[model samples]
Target: MSLALVLDLFGTFFFAVSGSLLAARRQFDIVGSLFLGSVAGLGGGVIRDLVLGQVPSAFDRPVYLIPPLAAALVVFFLLGSVERFRRLLLVFDAGGLALFCITGTVKALEAGMNPAASALLGVTTAVGGGLLRDVVANREPQLFNRRDLYAVPAMLGAGLVTVLWHAGMFGTAAALGVAAVVFGLRVLSLHYGWHIPRAAGTWHGSRRE
Candidate 1:
């Protein structure tokens, strides 16, 4: 019933939607759609929990896994109606990204990790699912090269949470504020075509060999 848990659940729902949208777009079967949705919803948290030496809640908690799989099923049954809202799913993914980062950091702190380590784990929790999604989808992860400020925003938010926690400002307000900043950065980057610097003289993806 805590606000953090609320955000986490909401994040799971939206990210699941995003995954379901992708699966539909790719014409994946029902099983594949469900697999992607579950991965997008719970993959990051699972990695984070494993790293912290805790049992992943999604493994036993139906609440964490149900929403995503249900979403996938919804999309499977109602493809035409759902596909129109595909664009909105990216926004949902961004929200999920921000929530997961903050929640991950907070959870790491609760698990006795130092601020720095907690922040790093936060980034891991925020992006692990997306990475897995892309890999399983047989596409390159979007975080590679200079693909807009994705992971960097997660890092920034995590860093902010660490600093605020260290400064005795650890509270719901602080966490929400930091998450908003990260989410805003991601939105602005998408709007303005902002991108990080890539390696010198390196081509992304392919060079048309």
Candidate 2:
């Protein structure tokens, strides 16, 4: 497999693991965990393909389904051990975000998308599956909330890849390097509680005596 394809597979596996663990934490049954894991693994790629006017890449290959299913099975058996695996979940999720961000930006640029569009597509590809998983599990989507620095890191990663490609560095080495930078940034942000600032506002009410 090519380097890009390998990174995609790794990202898919980690996304699936994150989704499965979320379902297990919610006390969902095995079927639910499998379903969520599959969605979280493939949903973003499906959306990315649709937007790019192509058939979903995951459907074209069996490897796509295998990894998520394997992840679901593993999480299902270890459902009760969730607390012990929290750190692993964070690491995998961060790695997946970085991998998908780079891959998605590369694919978008390959399709002749503009830099801004490519970055947006990359962010969507990094977080779309997790958003869907959260919605399905009846929780607020993490990307939309201000709790974490999730989407910003992906955007930075995508932007970096785009900049590198524009600078004539569109190769496997460049992609991996960009992904590593994104991964490190994301992990550090999580460790240090780094986040984008939000708009400040105050609410006031008047009462009549």
Q: Which candidate is the best by TM-score?
A: 2
| CA lDDT, every model vs. true structure | 0.82, 0.83
lDDT of 1: 0.82
lDDT of 2 by residue, 1-209 (tens): 88778888888988899888888888898889889888888888888889999889899988888879999988877767665855666676787788888878888998999999998999899988888888998988877666478888898898988898899977888877878888888788778888775645323343321
What lDDT is reached at residue 53 by model 2?
96
Question: In model 2, which runs have C-alpha deviations exceeding 4 angstroms?
Answer: 78-82, 201-209
lDDT of 1 by residue, 178-204 (tens): 879988998888878898765654466
Give me candidate 1's TM-score against the actual structure: 0.88
- The ten-residue window of minimal lDDT in model 1 covers 200-209
